[model samples]
Target: MKQDLVVDSDEALNRKMYLVNNALDEIGFTWCHAKLFMLAGFGYSVDSQLDAIQSSVKVVVDRQFGIDFPVATQIFYVGLLVGAAFWGFSADIIGRKLAFNLSLLLAAVFRPYYWWNELVSHLLAFGAGGNIATDVTIFLEFSPAKYTWLTTFMAAFWGVGQTVAVLVAWAFVPSHLCLAGTPCPSSENRGWRYCWYTNSGIVLGLALLRLFWFDMNESPKFLVSNGRDAEAVATLHAIANKHERLCSLTLEELLDCGEVKDAHDFKTNGYTVKSVFSAAVAHVKVLFCSKKIAYLSTLIFLSWTLIGLCYSTFFNFVYIYIQLHGGNTSGSTYITYRNTSISQFVGIFGPVLAAYMVTFKRLGRRGTMAIGAIITMGILFGYTTVRTQLQDAVFASLTYFFINIYFACLCAYTPEVFPAIARATGGALGVLFSRVGGIFTPLIYYYGLKSGSSVPIWVCGAVIGFLGFIALLLPFEPTRFRSV
Candidate 1:
């Protein structure tokens, strides 16, 4: 009997692994989706759009909008925040696959509308909301506990997307047809309108790829929890086939384990508004219910929040500062922007560094996050003290390197702390909090510019670094512990 039990357990494990691989395949597409969506929305092409509008309709549109440039930027960001909230909740209620496909479809369909009116601007924001939320949830759900740390590398695709956006903009903008009669030697070759149309096409193509070629299996974990045993078994078999692995236990055996109910009668009758509240509440409880977990969640949250704040604050103002201090002309601002883009491209090494640390040393999530935080803090301090343009650029590049590392750590750490059931919601909560810090970053930079002081930079740096120290107190050590 004991030998039989051992054999059964081994089979169960194999089936689980199969499911995980299948999930990972689908989740991988989300990373690509997120990268493209973010790039198209906020990347270098966005700058081109603003430039075109500024040259063509600045006086008329600016007056009609009744908002200055800074305010308009804020409005755009606010739209992003609203989108995040709206779509994040929707993903939890709907299945991950549906949300995933919808986000891509919406983004692709509405992107071209940007040329017609500012309505496209709002659509872009909405699309971003769907893209990020769905991507976060699906990726977290599909990843296996053992390799969860890879989520950060997946998240870094966002940076890749941003990099591609910058490169494309560099290649196309200014050389394209001039907007508002602002002439460039290369203007004869490129047109600003072409940028929007091209991006729209790319997103639409990706959407179709997801819809037709990609298999959209429902998460078995989710299916079991919802009392869909047969469907879950089918999904498990599909997973096993995809991974080319043998699953020892049959669906009947899994049903016998008592983890899943026999009846499909498990209804949502008990689910209510209060149910949603309870779900959210339970999410917090899982994190803070244990001393170990509480310490881990707090530390990661603080670290990510501060990281978001510092990154947003610095990048928002970097172009203006570089132009004023680096002695770049208006015409060369694009070049300066491209320089930062290059810095980001080089910064991919940071994620690579994180991948190595987690895979080789098995430092786990907490240790990696702590290390990244320390490096980021040091880089920020260096950035504040540096005065020369060349030194500034170098320091900025170094900072990005560490920031990317920190981001990778954060992406891995946040989801690993939660139970599979709550993973997506928990990740979303962390992202929401981090974005709160990001939201205020622009305001902080605006004030800093007006005051002509490095105080904001220093203070922000200190706050973020301090949070990292606090993160060490969190309970769950993902490197040492497996996901529940």
Candidate 2:
């Protein structure tokens, strides 16, 4: 009887999750889900917002600070690395609601941060970068399993944010920047400040929308794992009430499953920290439950790391190269921002196509990811050989489109591959490694890259191609498989 009970443990817990998913699926897609998608995507949007803002203002920033490279972007990457640690653990400790909004508020309310611009910029970056994973996790919990592809499709917000940032930059930087061989002092160049102010206003508005526009619920699993079975059931019923659907799940049924032992769970010995650590250990053990999952996790983590390094080293600096080093007279700052806006707008479609292609049985998520990565790598290699402005635009646009395709698949795929019990732990660790890899970009810029040299671009392409091969090695493909 004891052995039989042990065998039924995971099965019984999964039964609980199955019921919750059923309740969510029955509610179907509504304005609620749509609103949640857009709102949760704010986190995704802010990430690219900061990236686009910093990259577009690189010239002015470099000039303003008397630096060679834009250190703000580098500092942003460092913030992402450090911020991950705090955000990862805090969500579970303090309720997700405060933690989520607090991060956005911290980022937005920096108008008084004039004492030290660079220091405050990194802090703002920290606030924005930290909420990314939290946003994805929250949305996934509310998502109907059938529409899981929306997770990838939601990446469209990233492009939207980036395009808007570039447009703002274009509006301000063209007539305000210090041109090559032209004197540009802080008094003369107000464009970068305008860009920062505009971005901060936009972010502040998002925080307000998140706070007042939508009322978010605590994740059902979070409640279940904490022995709040009644609340978990009530939360599901509330969503069904809003959507006019009948949920068949009952509080007693959830209680019948015994203690929730699945996702966001801990093995409690009535010891606080030790229990949490044990829960994390159990989560990690489950991630490597088999050779298949083990290999896939390693490949996924490695893929993220390479992507972080390669993308930061290439894309972050590619615009500067196009503006300053390309052949002929098209290297003007105005033309660079204009072309960048176009490229960003075109990249918005990549995630859409990725969402569709991932459902293909022959290709599935793994094939889509592999194909996108390889094509993007090829495009990056082609970018190195472009000699004219038109060629640069075409190559750069294609690279953004395919990189978004690859990236959308990755963001969706990582969450899908990990079991619920270990999903958060594995996903956080993956982002942590990616940011760790990204921090080396500044080091490369400091040590290896030279102005007008395409060596780093070429190396980035080579590493990405290697990552494409690694994408194929991911053994567990969660195409039609529902994440538990």
Candidate 3:
């Protein structure tokens, strides 16, 4: 009788894994619509930090606030540094749903007060960072193994945010704003205010949608890890029902797997700061205990650091770089925004293209990453030498395209590389280190630009290419193992 029960349980679990591999089964409602809402929310959250600063608000600060606008952007990143660690850690302990909900709430609360002081800017950035970590954590938890690649593909929405922000600026800023030097009344220079207000409204709306309409459940995997076997099985049923498919998993069958142990006692025995600290330290140590995992972790950490530096240094200053080189010769803000739109338009295709490339047998995740990085390096080098508008546009488009491909692979690969129990912790550490790199970027760009225009390009290009070779050292290729 015991043997029969074990066999039946194993069979049910196998079916579950098969369904996961086949993409949670019956794709339209569960896989498409639900995922789209999540993606939209993520895009909007990311924009609240980057799009607001670069597009209209920076201009408003220059004209009306009498503050150095660049400092506001820096302050946002500093907030991100703190938020990433906190949200990442919170997701593991408090549950993904709670962390996800609170991130958007924080973003909405702090964003309206951005120009008030640098402290608010940091707080808003904190929300942005939390949103990023929380978004990726929950989204990945719900995704089926076969479709995990979609996690990376969703980054195309990052470009969507950029394009929309540019269009908004083009529509309102140049048309309604007071002339550059001639300061004017608040009523006339309200473009930036309008931009921020609209962004905050969108964020609040998404938070409501998530809280009420979306009806997302806690992660079953997390439940199992915490020793809540019944809850894990129940959550799986909820997921299966959402997909309009039948799930045969039961609590008894789940316990038979034995991989998941009840950690309730471990969790509740001694809830103290020291215990929490010790647990965190132990989890990090596990990342390096295995030779293969240790090497892979090191490579991934280094790659994120390099990517952060390159991304912040280049994209943060793209507007100024273009304007200096003749983008503003017409003395029209429209031209600058239009060109920015073009770059984003080209970038939108990159993640999709990367997703397709990874599907090929010959060029899986590693191959795609290596090729994308190499291409980006060459494009950046060429970008520096361009003098004409056409050359600038062409090289800039190519640069963004390759960089997106690289990012799609890196972002998708990070969560997959870690064990389920440690996934959130691993991802948070990666974000923390990357933000550290970003914290240093403003200094690097300032000095590099002072040295020469080409200096920043060379520095960014070299780091990207060097990291590509280091990526080759990753111990486990996702293609070699089944999707986690």
| Candidate with maximal lDDT | 2
Q: Model 3, range 1-484, lDDT digits (tens) per residue?
A: 0001011122333333333334333332366345544653473336433433443456565566555426765666678788888877766666677777777666654333335745766765677675555566566666654555676676677666666666677666776678767866777876766665666666666667666766667766556555666776677677677667766666666566564321322445746777667656655765675667788888888888889788878765554455566553233677756776687779878888998888775777888888899889888777656666566667778887899898878877776666544567677777777788888766764564445455677788888898778767676666544432
Clashes of 1: 13
Off by over 4 Å in 2: 1-9, 92-95, 109-115, 180-183, 261-286, 317-330, 447-453
Residue pairs with backbone atoms closer than 3 Å in model 2 (clashes): none
Number of the top TM-score candidate: 2
Query: For model 1, how does the per-residue alpha-carbon lDDT over 1-484 read when each residue is reduced to its tens digit?
Result: 0001011122333344334444444334334334433332232123222222322222223333343444434444555555556555545544555666666565553322223435555455555544443464455454444455556565555555555555555665545533443433322423444555565666666667667766667756555544565776776566556656554436675555454211221244455676666555553565565565566566666665676577677766544454444443234435545665676677767777776777644465556666776777777766655555466567767877777776766766665556444455556566666566767865765675666565655675676577566656655555654443
**lDDT for model 3:** 0.64
- Model 2 earns a TM-score of 0.90
> Local error of candidate 3 at 251, Å?
2.2
Residues 338-402, candidate 2, lDDT per residue (tens digit)?
A: 88889899998899999999877688778888888889878888776676778877887898899
Q: RMSD for all candidates, in order, please.
A: 7.1, 4.1, 5.2
The worst-scoring run of ten residues by lDDT in candidate 2 lies at: 1-10
TM-score of each: 0.75, 0.90, 0.85
